[model samples]
Target chain A: MEQEMVLKNENSLSSSLKQMLLKLTPSIKKDGIIKSLKNTGITLLSILMFIGLWQMGSKALYNKEADYRIEKALTERGEEAAAAERACIESGDSSCQPNTLPSPSQVWASLQSLIADHNLIGAKKNAFAKKMAATNEKMIAEGKDPIVYTGRASFVDIVLTSIKTVFAGFLLAMFIAVPIGIIIGLSPSLRSAFNWFIQIFKPVSPVVWYLLVFMIVKTLYIGDSSDNAFVISFISVGLCAMWATLVNTAMGVASVDKDYINVAKVLKLGTFQKVFKVILPSSLPLIFTGLRITLSVAWMVLIAIELLAQSQGLGLFVWEEFQNGANDSNSKIIVAMFVIGIIGFLLDRLMLAVQNMVSFNKNEMA
Target chain B: MAYLELNNIYKTYGEGENSTEVLSNINLTMEEGEFVAIVGFTGSGKTTLVNLINGLLQPTSGEVLFKGVPVTDTSHERGVIFQNYSLLPWLTVGQNIYMAVKEAFPKESKKVLMERVKEYVGMVNLSPAINKRPKELSGGMRQRVAVARALAMNPEMIIMDEPLGALDALTRGNLQDEILNIWSQDKRTALLITNDVDEGIYMADRIIPLKPGPNATLGPEFKINIERPRDKTAMNDNPEYKKTRNAIIEYLMDIGDERKTVSDVEYKLPELTPKSFVA
Candidate 1:
């Protein structure tokens, strides 16, 4: 009986120990889970802090009573103008007051309505026209004529148009920029001959390019068509954005290691194969960086061309908002600007992710 | 007749007002299936001579004949192992070796080619890390991979430019033995560029010192009549090894003294300052 009891005790103790070890293994992994949670909390706190700071700064800038009062007056004037137009007469000094600026709350409401309308009807040519017609009809029902209060295009409509043109221009710019840059960077004689041109054009300002493109397009195309204006604006934006891409490509190709070139030669690799497989892949980091910069410059120049030419795009939307002088239009413009910045940021981040994927040694670049 | 010869070569950089001669009246010959080591100090044009022989660079005057034909450009027959372990970082160990193997034998089927690669990779004892990229391997492993790569091509001649110079002593010793075993099996014409006198004595049938430059060229060659398959532990104890090492050391020391004498001339010059003129 004593031997049996002793054997049973030892067996139970061994089984319990195994169970304990199995439990502890998971507990060690659980520590990592807690550590990651703590990291996440810290990141969230930092983001909240940044947003709080931005809000506080914006409020402080508009804190003065004169500025605050002017914003209030503008809101009141905008409403009065709408009501007076309903009565078929100008609202007089109250409608077109120069000193007044729309309040933030009024602008926010305007932006909300614009977003709701866009989401409901979409930003297509036919849908936008239909939405406008419905809006004009609603004004008539309220006993107001939808006059040429803002002769410029609708804020949302102009933004949509600008986005389309800029993307087309950006694509065109990429095609020309990357190839030219590679050629210039790789060939010594080409680099020497074209380097001066690159330097002269890099800092020449998008507005100047926009103007030159506009004049050239206008003079060249005598076609009596509305489509011609859109084509002209796109060409202008593309030319302005092309420089950043071209220079970057050239630099990337030029910076590939001499050692790699020799390796290619030793392998007896053909010229085209060497370029694509060895040289191009090695210079991916610089090339991707150039692409990111070119994308942002293209977006920026696209808006500038639209604003200057009063052509379609986000630039035109911002310009239209300023002319409209209504609280809603001003707020809509602010929202459009936010959307532009956010999109550009996302595009750059995507390019960076792509760069990380294709690189040979990630740690060296990081 | 020598399999490859550098007949009284001259190489100079720049011209006219800024001319600088790098090598002058250089003459050397490499025999077939011979392991020759050239020991030199830094900037001794050892690498330049190797480059000229490999046809990566051409000499200004003399001819570099390989199998009695002048080497003008890069060729598969004259395989060069660079100092930098110039393996493509993006390519895996097996792939890098396979690239050269494929170029050396393009008509061979993939199966046979890969089998050859596996065999060579196994020889270097790197069959485990065959799929790993260059960056993933340690420095010693990378050098071994380079050795395996060169051997896989089965070139007529293999030129190594300080192949083990960057390695740790233990790794260097291991690779040196491995290289010797491979060289003995085929007796390929091998030229090693090294500054290690002891290493040269152990490996080569003969040692040649590339004298230091402004105008550097090969000095007198020393024959090591030591028996095949040298023992490193016993090398220091051997009288012939000691004598050969001391003779080469003495020659290097003399060259060093000559360089010092050339540099010290300005310091020992008669005073030519304004005070001297006044006196």
Candidate 2:
């Protein structure tokens, strides 16, 4: 009886432990959690590998460039000059640093430096704002222009400007494309008529669009002193990126299932109801896909337009850094490249999430 | 006057030399509170006929008259259950039905429309899947939603174009009974286009055969004498069921044979004789 009692106690303890583990598990949501965990693990591993490769490549390129520079000095001058160059490189002097590619660590350092620079500029701007705060309020009350900060824009400010311009361009593209797309989609003749126009303009380079927009904007604001580069940049971006949305929307609208159209008809739906209730809902997935592409394209072209228009944006920052050609300038450009890429990815994901929300068929898009 | 009429209808697609005649001389008149079925082979323009009657397609050479007036466009009077179950995939089952109900009764309150949708959805036994999208539902469930959407409109007439063709036999029977039960309630004028003779005989008051295309036309009509609330299991023992079923099958078989011979005549005979005359 004592041995049996001990055995029962042990069994009960083990059973309770098993129950606790079962409770601790994800239960119904176990699959999703485990899947996401596995994905995160793989992503982390891949990112580590990418940094490793980037570091190795950066070292190899630096060494190759250093060796070439030393060899050229030796051939042109003498062994003394080659030794001096080698010592400069070994000492890690900024003057002898390779400018071809920046390592991950260098890019990270440059990001910190840029942040610090932004902080300094931000402090100065704050001081200027405080000094002018009372004067600005008085000017506002008097219905006149206020004293403003005319200092250089910091890195963060530039990024925000770029984002604002891109969003404005995106909105502009949406307004121009969706309505025209719907009109063309509603009529076969209009689609055919616009086909050539869309095809021709779709392939036009962003540079050309920028020039066209500049010509118009320049004429419009010829005598005006207000900033118009933002206007020009957004307009050019919109013109450059609106094609994908227009074409996709037209195709989506035109290719709605005939059966659905019949359903609309049998219900005796009016034209507005037919398009809004039946047609748009049916084609929303494709339309969202078009919008996604348009947004990405707008983002990509926004940089070029801003650069050409000389707007205070990330593009301008990158261009200025490129022209600056300082020791850390290449790394600054690399940092900007990463920021652009990450922002672009997030924008696409934002669109995909919205697309999934509206579309009926899930998992097909991703 | 009939409740719905297809008078001297002729439909052809394309133009000039490219034109193909799809329907020829389709004169069908459906009375109020009547159930009629047009049974035909696949690709014999039965859908076209249904479209013409529903005002989805204009007859190439004739007018579709309803209530003694020419029918030019679609109206809520005729609610259609499409062959492909064209339930918008984006909308849930209730939403799909609600769309039709709302469109049909624009003046109705939202609460009343929701109740009506629920009632019709319950009628089709799809209340369990009322919140599910079309993609989430099975083929049979989708068809049920389509049926609910059409019936929820409370149209004066119901027109179905092979609505259950994609479903399995069991689901088909279930839906047929559900549709018949709802039809008998109001006895609305109904036109059912199908390829199954037994299904036509079981549900419709009269079954008409659409002879095969390229110029398909209606053949003789067979009247069903089966009593209401007919049993599927007992149908085998019924004498009238056997007689009507056999007649329709034989007529369809004869038409199929005729189509085969017509196509065979057009096939060219190959010459196997040696060109060099060396044999």
Candidate 3:
């Protein structure tokens, strides 16, 4: 009787399941979901472990520094002073802080503090715009320049500026590098002539490029354009980062398949058609590889250029926070570092996606 | 004047003591609508000879003339099917042929151009793979795309340089029949370079052997008197087919033996007297 009852239940389930799943293959969706869930769990666990290790390290350093302070007090001012120092440190006195690596909690606090500061600045800017609106309108009607609100950029604003500068620099590099590369690649004499030039300039430092750009930009702008810093930073970034793209594009174009060239010749293709159709298509994978390198280079050089050129960006934020030396300055810097790393990783993934779409030489990513 | 001619062509590489004469005094001529095959060993300078005719490589000391004009550079009039498929990996089968068709007849509308591509691709029985990239297709399929591309150009002279050399035997035989059918339709002047004796005999009006190089030159031409639209199975039993096949194979064997004899010098073998253990 129990067996019959179980059989009846099984028959009902199978009748419904058979309608839903017509194919013979097993449940792939369920497997995929389980696999992804496992991966996510592992990722979460590893991150938790990292945070625990960091907390331990931060506490150890703090204690060591605190102990050193207490020992110094004992030697210099005897037992009473040592006792007082210990009391001050234990009471969370800012003056007696044991400056060391900030714990994860402190970094999280800094992130929240940054968000609040951004909100405060955002309100101030809105108020400023409200105050300036009438005057700016009047000035515009009178054929005079509108009054602009100049304020300190928030952390998010600064990051966006860095992103914008990197993109501009990347565009500059691609434009300047690709055309010149194609020309040099097509002609053997030009390649030979430029080889030494490329080798010499390829490894130039960002700081040197920044100064060179500053020298030209300073002369180019007669007055306070306020765009000078941005122009200088982006130009320096382009000059510093373009070498990889230039070299790779040249190599890619040069190493286009000889068979393709023979095909182009047999087809009786014109110069323009041949280059665009045959040469470019065949060498695309290498060119994209070069461009990927160039983008990463542009991003790397942008930070240094921004710092040197006094451009408003993440670099400036980090530098200012470092110089500020407040209680939470180090924590803020740590937050910025993580943000930079994550953004850089995302940028690389973006380029990889683009490369796979365009290259046609498909295999899994290296 | 002959439709196409090679006037005592020679191709040499390097200079002074290092110089090697590749093709020595290669002379040939073909009238309109003739099929010719140059059969040779694998490493014999057959490709060099094809390149010379197609104007991809200049003959070191002579000339290739077509229709009483010096062949200086590649032209649409002379379409070549390279040994390697040479299909652009980025383009689909249809696009590969379309690119050639567009170049050959630039004034045609897009509609007409596409029709021609579809027609040729279908002719090769690759209609199913029209949208597939060269990388996606098998070796024979890619080669068929190449054949389609060359045929679509509608060249006066078709130069096939061992185009089916990389395929399996069945595929090779199938492509051979397809090419022969195409040739019979227009009787387009064609030059086939192959190492396969049977391929040469089956395809060409005249079978010429390229003597293995150092100085690979064309040997005496054998005019294949076997008629076409020739049936493969029936021809095997025919006396004329037997006679021609034997004669060509014998000539090829004799040349092979001669080359071997020239290269094979007898060396005195050292007498292997086992060294005495006392020594």
Candidate 4:
């Protein structure tokens, strides 16, 4: 009877399953759902693993709570010393006054108070306005007369000016460098003639370029025109950084395989077509590599040039931070350094991402 | 005049004191749709001869003519397939063939061009690897793509510089049959540069042995009048096949012997080197 009942139940279950399948005629397929679910699970696991690893690395690299630990230790030591000194002073001891390292709480409170009092947004805007006004005022005063400095511009104003100058310089460098580089690379005769020039100028420092350009600007422009300063800074960065793109373009053009050229020949491809299609695409990887390196170098050299030339940008910002630290506040320079590092890292990553996208091999990182 | 001819061709490297002749007094004639195989010992200047024909190189003296005109630089009319299977690594099998097809028929509709590509790719039995790059394919597979690339253009003649030399015996034999089948269908004027005597005997209507060199020259042409669709296993049994194959092997062996001791007797230098140095 139990066996018969089991048979009957199995039959009923199979029939019920068939009926359900018939009723749900257009329902989602089981296999597709399972496949999608599996993929989602995999993606989630990978993301989790990445996050976990990143957290571990961050913890290893950064000591967020280190100040507290160090301060607690110093405080304990300072208190012990202070108690001993008190006892000694009662019996007449030298060095009896309590001298202790500031506690973690004290440092934190100091930082908080500084942040609260900074008026950072207003100060930056005011500095920018004042610098612009000063430049205008200086230009007006320099019209048949010398201008005098009423007061110093704030750090924010100095940084804004520096950034504006570097960007202008960088743009000029890019425009001049890319076309000349392409022409040099494509033509053997041109490359040969310019090879010596490239070798001579490619390695010169930005500081030297800035100094030379500064002298040229002063000699050329008698008035207190900010344009002269901007021009000097641009020339400094452009001269220092143009070689990277130029050499890369030339090397890229030269390194394009002979086979593709032959293919172009067989196809009866015109000069423009060959260059645009076969040569350009083939050389793109190397050219992009050069451009990426050149941009980074230009960014770095622009900063150096600005620092040397006393032009506006992050380099000047850093310089001002240093000056401020020397004068009164110390940690502003540290904050600025960290900010620069983070920005540079982001820029490098953006270039890397772009390189990956442009590369023929998707798996390749550079 | 024959469809194409090389008359008293000479290709020499360097000049004056350091001059070395690579091909000397080479002459050949090919009628339309003729299949010729040139076999030689290693360093027999067979590749140089084919390069001259393909217009990849110019003969230092004499003339290489396509129909009646001198061969100059590279042209699409004579398609070449190299031994190393030079397919652009960046492009897929389809793209490689498509490049040639597009070149050949610039005015053809894109749809028709695509169809021709598919047909030719299928001709080499590589439709599956159409989307796959050269790097991802096997050596045999890459050569198939190369053949597809050349044949898809429908050139008037095909020049192969040891196209199957790199493959193993089995793959080589398979490609040889495939090449023959393709040749039989269209009968494009074909010149194969090979060292394999049997391969030459099996494929070509005429086999010419390139004598080994300080300067290599074509020895004599052996005409193979064997019936079409020749069986590889039974080819050995044919007297004509055996005779021609032995003759080529003997000629190559003699050339190899001659090349072995060629350096011992060399003794001339020209005066230009001294003059140039003085100036």
Candidate 5:
């Protein structure tokens, strides 16, 4: 009966569903539910232990004496003020203490408040748009341009801005690196000529690149503007992030199999056809590897560039919160940290998906 | 006039004291529509000779003439089936053939190209694997794709550098017949470079043995008088097949013995200077 069940499962129309059902049953088989349950139970238990430890540690470190002072200040006024002060202390207000680390509950509440703040901003944007629609229609009738809203960007908007900056930087790096790499890779003389430049520039930090870009942008723009900040930050990010891709692309092109080149030659392909058809396809796996590294570098460099340039992005938001030094600022910063990490992971997976689509060598994926 | 000629070819690598001569005094000629096989041991510069004929490599001191014109660079007139198959792994079997067909006949319509690709794929008996990449196919199937790709271009000459050297005996025999079938249709000028004696006698009208190299050269040509559509079993019983095979084997055995003595003498190291120790 068990053998029949196994065979049926193997030949099932929906094998994924069958597998899931099998995983839910408690059995000694390798793919059974017991193993999955144990794995999940261990993860949950560890997380619970960590939270419990954190809560206990926080209580021990917290200064109730600081709360007592604020309580005494309120009690000196009246019983009603004393009651309000106790409520405030219970509410975990940040103003009562300067150096207190937020408990997990406090951080959670901060997250909820941030969401509320984002929603409130969204409602304000909607109202502004509605109000502007009427004004814009009148302005159009009167042959005048509509006024654009200048509301403060929310946390979600800042995150989007950071994503946009990184993508822009990554694209710029690809455009600059790939063709140059291919050209250098094709000729030994060109590679030798550019070797010094690549070596010298590849190790330069984002800060140094930002300073160089800033000087150029300053001279070119001749005025302080938000657009200039955007240009400087992204350009700096691109400059700093492009080296890996450039080096990898050149290496990839240089190391393509000699047989493939001979095949191209025997086919009597033109230079363009040979490069596009044979060289590029064969070198694509390495090029995609370079691109993935370049993207990660671009993301890492973007934050520093944004912070240095005072641009409207997650980096700037984090830096501003750090400078503010409010009690909730630390929680918000932690939130941004998680967001950045998750986005970086997603970007890597995205590149991996694209690499799989283009590369023929499946073993290389591992 | 000879259709393809290599006159006094001498190919060497590196320069001056570092240079090693590979092919020396390699003079050869083939008539139009003739099938020739060059038999040689491994590392006897057979591939270099094939490369020279295909115009992929320039001779160090000789000219390769195709139809009385000097062979300068590779052209679609000579299609090569490399030993390693050399099908681009990213392209499907049909696509690999189509790439060559499109390059050879740029003026042909897309439909015509597709039809030609399908026809060639069918010719190789790989229609089921038409859309499969080279990596997905076995060695025999990849070699078949390589053959189809070369034949699809309809080149004036087909140069194969031990194309079936890597396959099992059964697959090799099957492909040999398939290649013979294709050659019979158009009778294009063909050259096969291989060390397999039976394969040479089976496939070519003329077989030339290549001597072992420090400077490899063609030894002698043996003409096969066997008729077409020759059955393998029947060839074993044929007097001409046995005589030709024995003569070629004898020649190869003589060269093998000669190579051992030549290498023993050639590879002596220079005497090292002895260092005097002070007391």
Candidate 6:
């Protein structure tokens, strides 16, 4: 009898467990947790493998010539004299030859130092602002103009400046391209008239554009200031990036479905209404794709433009680090490279999200 | 005077030497509340005729008139239901209908507009799928939404360009009934262009055949004098239905044979050039 009772209890427990499992199963299916977990595991494993290979390769490929030179110097000179040179090489000194190809750890340390430098600059700026506030108050009471703090930009500041310039150029490109694209797309005569200009300017190099913009901006500004540098660089970037957006927008507008156009006509929609309601909505996916490409091009051309224009941005930072020729500068440049790649990826993802939101074609989301 | 008139309409495509006349001497008239179906075989310029009536294309020689005024361009007074179910794929069914309704009654309040959209959506029995995008809906559902959108505008005349041609048999029958039910309520002027003679007879007050083209013209009209609220089962036993069907089939067969004979004679071999004797 007792055993029979125990079996009934066990059956009840099993039934409850099954009920709970059934309830949780739908949640798991809805969330796709298993699929996401698999993806995460794969990504982590690949990243780990990449880091492991990089570490092993860097150690195996140590500079033999530099080691030989260090050994020869140690033997030729006394221990006390060579100790300083050994310390410099052993400490991963930037000025030494053996430290040219930095390991991942060195890059990480450089990144940390850059962040630290940014914080230090922020604190300095805060102190300067406090001092300036006090000085300004005093000057105001005395009826005189207050002085401004003109300091060197930090790494974070340079990154912000680059982002700002690219967006400015991108916005400028959008404003110039979309309207002209629509007008050209709508009228065949206008398209033919502008086709020659589009074909010729599309292939022109960003460097040539920079030179042209520099000549124009130099005459306009007539001063050597960072602001002037930014204006010239972004203008060049805008001119170079605008072509893709313009061409894509025109193509998109021109290829709009004939049925939709007929629908607009049948509805007696005005020209403005037709454009905004039908043409723009239908062509948005292509326009966004063009914008994405244009933004990437703008980013790529920024480094060269900044190097030539001497603008205070991440591009300038990279150029400066390359010219610095210090042992740590290489690692810093590597950090900058990673930063640029990650930011580009993020910008593309942002554009994709916007495109998906606006586009009716869900199959093309990827 | 007829509500819609196509007077001696002649339509030609291309230009000069290469031009082919697709439609010729097309004279037809539709009364204010009449449902007329233009039946034809493939390539009969039925679509061209529909386009001309819709004012999407102007005739090369003749004129299209609506309410005694020459039809110069497309207007909201005549709404079209296209074969491809041209609902904006990106928009929900409700939004698609709402766009037309808004255009038609621009001065209506938002609340009133919403009610009108809901009312028309309910008319097609597609209230459940109103918020679904066209891509998400079936072909029949999309066509139903197209019908709702066109009807919601309360157009004075409705032009259907083989709107049911792509649907399955069941869906086609269902939509035909729904369309007829909607028409019974208001008796609005509607023109259906279809290749299906049975569909034409079932829905239209009169059935007209368009002859095979290049330079197709309308043949004799077959009037359907059956009573209202037609029963599909009862149509089989109806004598008038049998007679009309036989007449249209015979006419179409004659044209088909004639076209075959013409094509057989039209094919000819090009003259062979003499071989050149250049060494």
Model 5: which residue pairs collide?
Answer: none
Write one digit per residue (lDDT tens) for candidate 6, span B1-279.
989988999999999999999999999998999999999998889888889889999999999999999999988899899889878777799988888898899999989999999999999999999899899989998999999989999999999999999999999999999999999999999999999999998999999999989999999999999998999889989999999999998998998998888878655889999998994
Model 5, global lDDT: 0.90
- Runs in model 3 deviating more than 4 A are A1-45, A130-143, B265-279
Best by TM-score: 3
In the range B1-279, model 3's lDDT, one tens digit per residue, is: 999999998999889999999999999999899999999998889988998888899988988999999989999999999999999988899888999999999999999999999999989899999999999999998999999999999999999999999999999999999999988999999999998988888899998999988899999999988888888788889888788889888998999999999999999998898879996
lDDT (tens digit, per residue) of candidate 4 on B75-168: 7888888877867666788987887788788899989999999999999999888899887889999998888888888889999999999999
Candidate 1 lDDT tens digits, A62-89: 3453344445655777766545444332
Candidate 5 lDDT by residue in tens digits, B35-120: 99999999999899999999889999989999999999998999999999999999999889999999999999999999999999
lDDT of 1: 0.80
Give per-model TM-scores: 0.79, 0.88, 0.90, 0.71, 0.88, 0.86
TM-score of chain B of each: 0.94, 0.95, 0.94, 0.91, 0.95, 0.95
Q: Report the C-alpha displacement of residue B146, candidate 1, in angstroms.
A: 2.3
TM-score of chain A of each: 0.68, 0.88, 0.89, 0.59, 0.82, 0.83
DockQ of each: 0.48, 0.75, 0.74, 0.29, 0.74, 0.69
**How do the residues A1-366 of candidate 3 rate in per-residue lDDT, one tens digit apiece?**
533343354555577565345233235534655799999999999999999999999999999999999999999999999999999999998998898899999999999999999999999989999999999999999999997768889988998999999988988998999899888988999999999999998877889889888998899897875568899888888888888888888898999988899999999889999999998887778778888998898888787788888899988888988999999999999999998888888888999999999987797446
lDDT of 2 by residue, B98-142 (tens): 988989899999999999999988998888888988998999989
The regions of model 4 sitting more than 4 angstroms off are A1-175, A211-235, A309-312, A326-330, A361-366, B264-279
Per-residue lDDT of model 5, residues A1-366, tens digit only: 563465455564466776666556525444554578899999999989987887776665565655666568676887787677666666868565535555677668777888888899999989898989988999989999887677888888899999989998999999999999999999999999999999999999999999999999999998655478888888898999999999999999999999999989988888999999999999999999999999999998888889999989989998998999887897788778778888999999999999999898978795
Best by DockQ: 2
DockQ score of the complex predicted as candidate 4: 0.29
Q: Model 6, stretches more than 4 Å misplaced?
A: A1-95, A137-149, A223-226, B106-115, B128-130, B265-279
Clashing pairs in 1: A162-A313
Docking class of 1: acceptable
- TM-score of model 3 vs. true structure: 0.90
| Clash number by candidate, in order | 1, 0, 0, 6, 0, 1
